[model samples]
Target chain A: METFSVIFQLLLALSILVVLHELGHFIPARIFKIRVEKFYLFFNPWFSLFKYKKGDTEYGIGWLPLGGFVKIAGMIDESMDTDQMKQPAKPDEFRSKPAWQRLIVMIGGVIVNILLAFFLYAMIAFVWGKDYVKNEDHIHGIEVLTPTLVGDNLFQNGDKIISIEDEPLSELMQANNKMLINQAKNYTIERNGELVNITIQDEGIDYMLKKESIVFIPRVPTQIDSVMPTGIAQELGLKKGDQIQQINGMDVSMFDQFRKELTTMKENNLDSFDLVVNRNGQELAFSSRFDTTYKLGFQNVFFLTHDFKKTHISYSLGQAIPEGIALAQTTLMDYVNQFKLIFTKKEAVKKVGGFGTIARIFPTTWDWKIFWSRTAFLSVVLAFMNILPIPALDGGHVMFLIYEMISGRPPSDKFLEKAQMFGFFILLFVMLYANGNDFYRWFTGQ
Target chain B: MAYYIGVGIAVVIIAFFMAATQKARGYNFWRYFIVSIVVVAGIYMMIENLVLNPK
Candidate 1:
């Protein structure tokens, strides 16, 4: 059922983007008097699920959900319509159009993708507003992931991240981006009632990306908020407001730390362990055996009980337009920055995911806010990817068209055909490699 | 054990597709066959180290 929802959302988002992207080309081609042979929502190799012809254009939905296309007359695209290209150029065909017109036609899809991103973001802002936790609101500091903290001693278990370099950290959400994008030299943190500076290393950034781990999260005390009547905690007489202090004589103050200690106990083959909890200013000890699933069977204190507060920024319809554009600009820039890491950092390639990873991002139960945000982000990604100067992509055609406009000589049709084939193979290789990584990860339960 | 079997199957399928592509594109069979093996091996090693066998 969860898988079904993910697949549904992925398909729905892709279909919307594909249709809009094709319309970007179809509209301009029609205005410029270029004949459009087909406008498809997906690739139809041998047959389409549904199709209809109207006024020199066949509108259809293809069975393959990979992507869609608008086939302009006399255009040598993925369709590889070389037979028609060999014939004399018709006045209404794409080949007979001026260089500028052809360039616009080629770039139309990318333009529409960007515009769709901006529109979605604007609508989202107007409807839901932006909500994020401020850095200062993390009164309990941060609970560093054990692996990350142990691997790199730059951060302690309860360290408050004050600033990256000299800039004050404003939003908790922006910390990782600021660190990665700026490549900060120093991290200032409030630790053990004193300010300390930790030198940032490029290797640390690489490690985080390689591991795909959140280095640290906001720390909250492990206080019992609820206990099941038939659970082990209730059986042991544990009540609400009891602060867990230690497990088996090992210090475990935070909820995550307590959980980690239990995991370590299970790994050590310990069936029973002692837990010390502070109740009403008095320390008390209790012993309990792990259940079959290795759980204590109690709920920890919720984060809302802490001082953390979410700051919301609402906008009027008029205000949303500029804010939305600004959001889109930052989103595109951030994506490009991250994309560059894939090439520079050797381990970054492992982070590249296929359909499985994409599906996991969607909530099992649908939420419109998350769906719109993911769709907007995917739109930006699609726009950037299609604009790469690789043959068989929109960017490749635009690159050639620009060259022709500048040099006053178009590359031969045969050369274009070969380039298209080469580009197709390169894309195929990348797709297989990415999907193979997904398969390997899933099969190994990574 | 499963990793080895999966890679073996992938190599066979990739080789078959590589052959089909080479035939369709009128390229030398042996040249692309070797290239396909190298590419597949490289991808497999990468997945092992970066993903499956990460420290």
Candidate 2:
């Protein structure tokens, strides 16, 4: 059921992207009086799920779940129908168009995708505004199971996190875990008012961020607010009002200590552990086997049941447009930076994820706000991916058009065909690799 | 299999570079060799990513 829901959401998102992308071409073609043979929601090479001819255009949904297209008559694309090239070009045909017009037609999908991302982002911003958790605001300090071994010095309890790579603590966590793990950043903290500099240990940090259920800070309350069904704490016979005091014979003083001890246990076979709880003014002992699947399978009822201090700023109509445009630009820049990282940095390589990772981005429990945010983020990604100068994608066609415009001659059909074939293979390999990562994560329970 | 895919990716990337400079005469062998080296590097990285000791 979960898989189906994920697939359904993914398909919906893809379909929205495809429709807008194809419409980008279709609308432009019609405006220029060009003949559009078909408008498809997905590629329909052999067969289509449904199609209908209306006013010289056959509209349809393709069986292939890959992508969609608008077939402009007399255009050279994936459909390498050389027979059309053999015939003399007609006035309304794509081949009959001027260089500049053809350029726009070729780049139609990419432009639409970019616009869609911008629009979605703007709308989301207008509706939901923005939310962020400041690093400094985590005044309780970060709790880690593994003692942070920075260079030679080991950081212990109540060690204030001031910054990463000389950055302010507020700014350090801005880029999510990317700054702490995959990318190295220096840290400067005001520990005991004597300023100390620490280079965040990336190796262990990367593992902690990527590993499932290993939270940078846990959500469990300091006092046991409630017990959940089948939960490790509950199954071990801990009561709703019980206060956790110790784990594994260590006398834990506070909730932070309890969390710190549980988190750093890397061994796979940690089956059972002892927990001493204070219940009804009495200390009681209980032992329970931890679920090997995830490090922990408990949610804090206290935290989950209450709302955080929300800082939602609703912008005026005038403010939203500029904000949206700026947001879109920032997102586009981030995508470019990420792409460049694939070439410049080695750590960035491991961050590459396929559909499984994509699917995991969705919330376990559906929320419209989260859904739109993810969709907007993905829209930006889609725009960037399509704009890459690869043969089979929209960018590839745009590249050819640009070359033709500058060189006073179009690329040879032979070269174009070869490029298309090569592009298809590249895309295939990427899909396989990404999906393979998902499969590995699933089976290994990593 | 991923290693081979990485190799394939490298080959295509090299092919792209080779194609881009096709008009530049007399470097076909060097281009292929350079591209082959790129492919090898890519293979090494893929293996490293896949099989390297997990942190």
Could you say which candidate leads in DockQ? 1
The iRMS of the candidates, in order, is 7.5, 14.7
* Model 2, span A1-446: residue lDDT tens: 77777777777788898798788888888888899988878656446789899998999887656667677888766545566767899999987888788878777877887888778778877887877555554444444444444333544444556765555655223434444433645655555667676655454444544443232342333466566676676556665567677777875645666665676543445667877778888988877677765333344334333233434578776787788888888777767766776675565555678877887788666678777767777878887898789887888888988999999998877788778767865765566566556767787877
For candidate 2, the TM-score is 0.72
Chain A TM-score by candidate, in order: 0.88, 0.78
Task: Rate residue A425 of model 1 by lDDT.
Answer: 62
Residue lDDT tens for model 2, B1-55? 9977865675665445432222121124454446545644564466557666444
**Which lDDT tens digits does candidate 1 get at residues A232-254?**
89889999889999988988888
Give the range where candidate 2 chain B is weakest over 10 consecutive residues by summed lDDT.
B18-27
Question: Model 2, A354: alpha-carbon shift in Å?
Answer: 3.5
Error of 1 at A138 (Å): 1.2
DockQ of all candidates, in order? 0.09, 0.04
